[model samples]
Target: MDTAVEEPQPDEFICPICLELLYKPLVLPCGHAGCFWCIHNAMQGLSFSTCPICRQKYNVCPSVCSPFYYYLKTMYPKTFAQREADIKKEEKDMREQSSPSPTMPEGFDPSSPASLFKCEGCHKFAENPGVPACGHLLCDECCVLEKCVVCSLKITYIPNVCASLRDHIHDNYAGLCSSGPLSSSGGGEVRDKFFKVEGPGVKIQMIGDTTARVEIDEENFLHFHLGCDMCGMFPLRGAVYQCLDCPEKVGYDLCSTCYELQKDVNTGKFNQTHTKDHKMVKRPFNVTKHHLILANNP
Candidate 1:
């Protein structure tokens, strides 16, 4: 029996312009093959009219009809058709991808009103209309005002006055005086008087039924006292030396002999003195009295 021989397959054609498989094949004057669309696009705006493959100058374009075109058209018709179809499909897909989606919001659409809300307090445009308690908007004042919404108290502006209001009112009605006036009852009249004349720092007052005022000027070394004279007494070497004459608290100093005698009396050593000797007794060395002294240096 005789066997049938197999036919050789045709070689695939490539486009010279894109270096790819030829689709809608067109042949240049120099016999080079390329896709018709690719060649047309390349030559669209070019001034030089020539065959790209052989550089042969062409004064007028030639007819594209040729035997090679028919051969490719009949032999690989499906491949040529598929390539043309693919190019169209790819172009359609790119255009679809580039076009904006219908779901996306348009530029500055009025459907959402929140984008137009503005703050009333600061007169600044904002996304919300509500005013903050601090009376500041995002676009308005840089700093927030510390103010009470109900009372309208500017707390930040007058902090000291605001803080002192309650205390001042309370102390006024409560009858609670400061230490400067109260210490007078305790024979602090001299210190209190000195402090009043000087300023507000350390002061003294006497603690008794008849209040006395004692002011002390520590810087100037001055002392003053006001009280019933009967209560005023100087402490000399642990013994009280009464100021007999003065009605207000008065200042007194002790001599060396009287101070030694007072010390002996404090140690339980009694010295009997007649009325004449008592009148002639020398003063003690150290005497404790309400007097203003230099506090900083002392």
Candidate 2:
């Protein structure tokens, strides 16, 4: 009996969408990398594009981040070549798999357009437009408008293709991918715990909005529950406190009651244990309120 051997692939080198090695790899905001063509095609016509595997919103369109690409090409040439072949096959399969969308506009060519990016500022198509880190596009004339249309953060421009349109130019792809994942498991969980979010957050007076901003609704409340480290109560809608300390820098939240009595000598509501000498930043609020103080019995 003749038995065939299975080829083992580096898990990090695999793209979930094509189920193959990444070709012209693009490192997504969700940290998942995939074939540039596969990703752009997968995201077409969607209101919002997200990671195909994790469903994390991909607000920014990614280029082939240099480090990872370099590793795949230079360090692991054989594997990289195999992955490239897989990408071509996957692409062909995708084209075959795609049924003409009933709602597709008349005369829409997915391949020709996916590579073409239009500048929002000038409203023109571009071949080599600059792509900002935030995934917005900019044409040559408009690349100078260095602000992300989506995020409003300052943009770094490359002065050629628009953000989404850069996929059209094959020459731009090159890089060294990061080393293998530290642990096969917990990669996603660890990222979720600390990934930076983009939103309209509350601005602190001293630190300014740049260093510290809390994302809240127009009513000034967080989307998630932040429990008070001091009183151990969930500060549901109250003004939460931020500890500018070592471990607490990672989000050791404080409730309003503890905040009000933080300076108390007897109650020890604030500066106790790890919180001692920690400077606290308070989230802004609109509640018209008063603090009722209790006298200490000596």
Candidate 3:
């Protein structure tokens, strides 16, 4: 009998930003897939959210492609495991070899939120630093907040942040749901979210984890509770409205744009039922990037 060694899968699983196995891979609006962190970092300081490969402007946030995910999970478990181990080892080594007693920039406040996370590039609190999927973020000040002094890793800054950071910044915007006469149009578009999507075609997975795209069937989208009933728009700019009396499927949800338009009830800009009579609540639209192939279709 002959023994054969396992080989790593094709480079499809490798992230262009870090040149490593995909970590929390997500599809960009341009039909390319990259690690969540890598995509986020690349989107910073650019006039258009252009894909690194095709230079297509990103119109909205993306989701993880499921077929690609299963290809790695079910088809190449050994490859996935080995890459994960390598990433962990690399991080450990970086942590040990990095500079010690790093100094903070002048006027650096010790009480700042990022004070605890020091950047090696500027020797200061790396406020909103871009964290690479495989290596680390350093000196992203030219592109975004915080100043990492490391300045060694080559990368860029992006407006889209990691799902974890978005969670902490949630609930800052207004929702479409209201108990009585509506308030302002959810105060215009929040523009805080990373992607925009349309109705009837979106394949939503309602899983709680925001780190990576979860693999689910198209039928699973039927159970999504956060869809806007009146509009096909997704949560790229803000949260979708929900109805207290009617189920999301029965036309109770409202997008922020529609909510603010019908503030007077008789304006007819967003002609809908008496929403003020319904009790509704707002939750962060914690959507992550979908798989690349699915993203192109969606």
TM-score winner: 2
The residue ranges of model 2 lying beyond 4 angstroms of the native Cα positions read 1-8, 85-184, 188-298
Model 2 C-alpha lDDT per residue in residues 1-298, reported as the tens digit of each score: 7595554454556677877666555655444566666775666221235678767654334544332344345434677787667655864885432111112222334443322234435545444445444334445555456454533544422332222223313223312112322222222321222223332223333355456333324433432334444333322344676666534222455555546745432111122334456666875554221110100110
lDDT of every predicted structure (CA atoms): 0.30, 0.43, 0.39
lDDT of 2 at 218: 43
Per-residue lDDT for 136-227 in model 3, tens only?
32223532433212322122223333322222113221121123222322111121344333332234454576643444333222223233
Give the winner by TM-score: 2 or 3: 2
Predicted structure 1: lDDT: 0.30
171 in model 1: Cα distance from truth in Å? 99
Candidate 1 lDDT over residue span 1-298, tens digit each:
6685443233336665676556544434233445545654555221224446545432212122222334344445566566657766864875421111112111222443222222223433332111221121222131134542322322121111111112222332223322212211110011111001122223455569677555543333221221111111111122223333222222222223333333222111011121222322322222114332322213
lDDT of 3: 0.39
Better of 1 and 3 by lDDT: 3
- C-alpha TM-scores of all predictions: 0.25, 0.32, 0.32
Better of 2 and 3 by lDDT: 2
Task: Give the least accurate 10-residue stretch of model 2, judged by summed lDDT.
Answer: 289-298
